[model samples]
Target: MSGMTPDTPARPEILAPAGDTPSFLAALAAGADAVYVGLKHFSARMEAENFGIGELTRLTELAHEEGRRVYVAMNTLIKPGETGAAWRLAARLARRVEPDGLIIQDPGLIDIARQAGFTGALALSTLANVTHPLALEEARRLGASRVILPRELSIDEIRAMGAACPEGLDLELFVQGALCYCVSGRCYWSSYMGGKSGLRGRCVQPCRRVYSELARQGGRPQGKDAPRRKGAPHGRQGEGRPPQGRAPLAKAGGKAGRFFSCRDLELGPLVKTLLDVPHLASWKIEGRKKGPHYVYHTVTAYRLLRDHPGDPAARKTAQDILELALGRPGVKARFLPQSPEEAASPDKQTSSGFLAGKIRITPEGGCELKPHLELLPGDYLRVGVEDERWHATLPVTRRVPKAGTLRLRLAKHATPKAGTPVYLIDRREPELQRLLGEWRKRLDALKEPPAQDTAPPAGGPRLPKPVKPRPRPDMLLTSGLGRGKEEGNRAAGSTPGRRAVPALWLSPRTAELSRTLVGRTAWWLPPVVWPEEEAALSRMIDRLWRQGARHFVCNSPWQRAFFPQRLPEDADLLAGPFCNIANAAALAVLAGQGFAAAFVSPELSRDDALALPAQSPLPLGAVVSGFWPVGISRFGQAALKPNEPFMSPKGEVFWTRRYGGTLWIYPAWPLDLSGQRREMQDAGYSFFARMEETPPQGLPELRREGLFNWNGALL
Candidate 1:
């Protein structure tokens, strides 16, 4: 292990994700500048193999000895009741491993770390959604030393944001791996479509699934009287357009459906631009869930490019390895400074792996091939014929290379016309099989025998006690108008013995229009505001608070960090779903931070919500019924006319609105928990029912009704 000596050149860090011990070893062997790992619990990648606290000493010590940094991701949202346990774990990690940085997403977790006197650096996770320079100020206020910028940004946007790094916080970019269709923090598609949440690390990847739209029809148009909604000004290409550049992955319901799937991030060519950006601290690889082979090859290519920028031969060799390693044609950086085409449509949604050769199935059976590239016996073959969008992957039984036409053995059932194109699936191959073993040995020699690990037994920390909540049949009702006439109707109509609270979310425009509305009771503020809206919003809050406004709801780390100092300590602080609280530890920490109540995520199942009461450190509330926000987008136009729904090819219309650079997309289906209210009360969590702006006519019904996570089922 090398020491961090003074004479060592300060190279830009290459951050890698290590899902488990073996991956961590691979990262070290392949020259990762730093390694990020997760604890067995509370990490965003819950499905991956993770390290428990007992293994921390070994992971961190090894990285430190090698003069490389190690960061632990305690990045998931914590429910109110579970905060104590999370804090205890964080405290234990901080006291023991003393990691180089604590990469986190939740505000409560940051409070917990500070409360426990954690002195190490804190890196804000992408789930925090720091998309602008102003947000970096908010991050600094929250004690973030660095921010992992979201992957949705264009290279131009990255450069613009990176220039501000010297002022408040350092910036990092995702240099490689699977790209999410929705912006990291803003997406709720998985939670809505599948019970699994991308935020909690149980994403079912609804974006990756195939969906063919049955039909399309016109939806309600925005009335002329409504506010004129717009998106980010155009970039010569178009205004807030669909992601620019790249071709579709595979044939979908044509190009329109292809917009829903994203090409994996492969920035080898554009990485030079990332490196050119001054003050950009690190380039991160995104796969903690990927296997060891993927990590090794990826790191190796980047290392070669990073060390020898001008060597074309070295660059070509590295590029070939990357192409073969990628398992498919790598997605070029269309949005980068230079590219072949204009940023128009999306890249192919399907990746067919590595191209083997052009092939044909002869009448005598077996297969004929051009044998252009190397192929191993174990590799799987995907045949795609030009005549049709024809594609099928089969195992390669044997390969006997000859001249222009070679002989190959495929499955007996396989048959394709002559001159059909072929691809080889990325599998164990001779090209890297021997190298893999060599790297494994090198990794083994770095750490001593008898794997060093010591875990504190359960009950080591004074965790918050689990107690059934003291039920007080109090329910809060809200409406669409961040302050409208129908807003307070439900809460104001509570019957005797039931304490109903009237709360309204107000915008700066609404606050100015109706001084009476902003002058009094409980009100919630928008989590993210445009720069121009900030002054007005600040003044509005000041006036409202002086007039005795107490209850407020926040949904971002930025808001949490900024709002506390402005509002008095006596205010009843509440958190919205963006806070992502789903367990007891999350609730306990928020309560400790002085939040009066926090909205439990709709992603929680009936069982999960019911379980919260026993561990809830503060009041638990649920939006029983309303439009579910599925995405918080920073790019693309969602031209939402107030009260009108945006229709999809699937025939579903979603209600949407724009706020600054963000567009909030809400599906038409209203999440209804009315039938489960009694059961929820019994579980001791407060219920907040949302009434429509204009409840539909004919016996009063919404277009669609859903149970959200009431069933608590996860895939």
Candidate 2:
């Protein structure tokens, strides 16, 4: 807030999502102020059929002509090898497409964008983890013009972030969208289970799959009581089998449910409250993967709610419009965290469609349905959620009255089981259809903008110079040992019989121990610090600094704010692994923010990992060995018992551990790169970290088969 000045209050713009051409046209027709779309590749929503460069170029022109803005989403995490291609994409958008803004998740892209000559606003994606009030200034310094606030924040917390936001930096909020069970940017569940990383936008949505919660006993879960719920959908099952030829554990009693499936966030009347929130520039709708019908209805409903909050008739009409939007049952989620509504109800279905009716297969091999609601021609119904084997979508060929039975001949290849749940996913009303037809005609008649030369320079982007090498050696972080007399004489930097330097994980409870280990031991800050925890963390850092701690590892780049303004010139501050630094440009950005070193993301492949250090602008490090968590979450499922191992229907095992106010989930095995230690050292990495995290009791010590993304591609 240094040189920041308040701007005059104005109505925030409504930003809508467009995953396909119809959705884009719908946004334009519905009077949306802005539309956000993704390119075919490098998009976080790869599941969506994103636009091509030429198509986006035309769309940008069309939006501009209508006085509306188009924000291009290239927000996925960038691998080391993909930097050049990403640079070319950015450059092309800057020149030919001329998008109003570029949404990004990777800090490396800050340098890449600047180098690519993109003058558009750089909006940081929610995955960048700018959670606390203190992080906003750092976000601006890192070149973000706007920050997409995380969905987990409350109204009060949002106001706090807005107040701390710097001038010239705007905030975008997800007023309506599908919610993720894990915090954005922190989740590794999908990537950990498979190579499909949520950060890179290839998430397979493991959180939506059904899971069986089991009671833990004797270092494993009792699987005999794992109930097989009728019609429970299945997908990638966990690896490993239950103990063979043995009775189930004595405590074996569990249930199956969609424990992690989250309800969609719909702030229908809540839009009025956000008006009081400062620095808010856009009310974003999330779901680029949704159909045009969803985009049109959602945009219209929000517009009406925002413009006529005081009008009873308009409010009622808006409510009706949203009810017909075909989204999952809406929840306010943690928006009002103090009196928070439960976002996930284990008993309810989490599919994003209207429950039409149960399906009954006739003996003649025809499909029979008792319609719960009136179904007209052009209505689309889905047999089940995507993971189910028989999941399929079909159009209604004829009208069916409410409670009326409708029998239809089925395709020979379609074999739906009896009693299967069917959901009405999409429909086009007569009025809506006519409006869409008009928009399509208008779009088809519009003239294409003149072509421009947008090719990159022959040699591609010039890389920044590497930082001067530092001599900080590899270290193993551990909880300090001993107390009083013997501890006073012990050297905290080195453990007996170990060659690596020693470090201590900082926590409020460890104040006395940290004091004992000060000077010699480097203090590793916690990976996440929520808004409420900020003051205590700041005080702890102040206390530690006064006690002479200088060597520190900040898991988040924003934690640099916790340090004193006037630091010793020789202070060694490092951006830790949780920062997710992957390329040289990201390291350069961190180096400018006063970090002396950083850890490269462990999710990179061998070639990409090895290629980073040579171009890095700060001394680099890696998480060499340890129990790297699958994800960090704010909510611990009520139906799933913590510290007790649970199994996916496919037999994979996982367990959760509560750390402070957050929940951490881990796979059965640990991440071990000890075998590649020599190779890493030879690759010019300045240091390596071996995490000594605590595992739950009853957890077995399995062989370290998890190499993370080191051996395979990080999708």
Q: lDDT: which candidate is best?
A: 2
On residues 158-263, what C-alpha lDDT tens digit does candidate 2 reach at each position?
Answer: 9998888888789999988899888888888888776899998899888888877655445332343221222111111111222222223323248877878888
**Residue 454 of model 2, lDDT score:** 39
- Candidate 2 has an lDDT of 0.77
Error of 1 at 408 (Å): 10
Report every candidate's CA lDDT: 0.60, 0.77
Alpha-carbon RMSD to native, per candidate: 8.3, 5.9
Model 1 TM: 0.72
Question: Which 10-residue window in model 2 sums to the lowest lDDT?
Answer: 230-239
The lowest-lDDT stretch of 10 consecutive residues in candidate 1 is 233-242
Provide the lDDT at 106 for model 2. 88
